[model samples]
Target: MTAVQQPLAPHEREMIRDELLRSLTKLERSLKSSGAAARPRDLEQDTVGRLSRVEALQNAGFTKNLEAREKAQLEQILSALRRLEDGSYGACNGCGAPIPFERLQIFPETLACGTCARG
Candidate 1:
């Protein structure tokens, strides 16, 4: 038996889109505040001890990795927004099935239905 999928209501879609926009804005602000991409590690500073320098470098690397992940998520959210604009937001990209509104609520940037996602 196939599960029937319902299209998201306009109100539901609007809510999700608003949430995505808020998330995107928050992430952009976070990325800007971190300045991970432009930050330079000054290893030669006389006031810094060797262990402190190593720890600082490690932290910087971790911060950069987090920034990259956040940027990727932002891109996904943007893509989902585009899909909404194109009237394809609630449809699975894999099997061309409609995605459930509840699932979309839990994962606003999903591109596929649960079955296609599992496969």
Candidate 2:
């Protein structure tokens, strides 16, 4: 039989919520500043040398990838916040198990517990 797990304490929930909010704010600012770097640049031969153009293209690609990752993380944070509001924040979505407080402390946006996440 599976054991029942206790829900998160109010203070613990508040702490995690605060951390998630802080992360959301930081990521939003980062995404805003990185928007220009991810844009396509003018790669005309006369405008920029071949090597410079290649470097610019590579940099843009890197920036785009970074922004994509940040955007995904932002979404995860938002989802976690919603779960918090709905009284489901620390519960694993897969099996309805309580995610360990230690794990939540490290990954406040996670939706699954370690076992379910690995599977």
Candidate 3:
């Protein structure tokens, strides 16, 4: 009998998780610091206050978006973890077929085979 291959093995998941965690950590720090850094200056207090307000708003928006994406990615990783528990990690979520190992290597969070993914 021929053995089927995993789209992403344990090592691959660990690598991707490391990358995602780094990005998420960086984004979190930026989000947390943007408002603090936007405080008005003493020399140009009036203009600085206005600019700070705008900067704070923009930073909040970016942080919100980044956080949302990060949460989604985390969920995807969690699903992958569950699949590992169930022995179905590499199967496409859409059509229940085995996702190609190559595709999983490139995108560890993949939910479908290429054909199903295209649709």
Candidate 4:
């Protein structure tokens, strides 16, 4: 028979919630600062040399990729916060298992347990 998992303690949930909020704030700040770097640069021949223009384009692409990753993390954090509010933050979405506290400490925004995540 499967053992019933205990729910996260109130303090544990609060700590995770605080960590998620902190991460959300940090990502928002990073995205705001990075917005300028991700903007398209004018590649006019008279304004910039070919090599320089190419470099600028490459840098912009890198910045855009970084922004995308940060945005995705921001969404995950937000979802986790919502789950916390709804009293379901520590449960694995994949198998209805209570995710281990150690895992939650490492990944406060994760929705699935390690086994589920591996699959």
Per-prediction backbone clash count? 0, 0, 0, 0
**Number of the top-ranking candidate, with lDDT as the measure:** 2
Q: Provide TM-scores for the models.
A: 0.87, 0.90, 0.62, 0.90
Candidate-wise lDDT, in order? 0.84, 0.88, 0.64, 0.88
TM-score of 4: 0.90
Find the number of clashing residue pairs for candidate 4. Answer: 0
Question: Deviation in angstroms for 111 in model 2?
Answer: 0.8
Candidate with more favorable, higher TM-score: 1 or 4: 4
The collision pairs in model 4 are: none
The lDDT, on a scale of 0 to 1, for candidate 3 is: 0.64
Q: In candidate 3, which residue ranges exceed 4 Å CA deviation?
A: 1-47
Error of 3 at 56 (Å): 1.5
lDDT of 4 by residue, 44-99 (tens): 99989989998998899899999999999999999988888877777888897989
Q: Model 3: how far is 46 from its true place, Å?
A: 5.7
Off by over 4 Å in 2: 1-5
RMSD in Å for model 3: 5.8
Q: Could you give the candidate ranking by lDDT, starting with the highest?
A: 2, 4, 1, 3
Candidate 2 lDDT (Cα, 0 to 1) = 0.88
Worst 10 residues of 4 by lDDT: 1-10
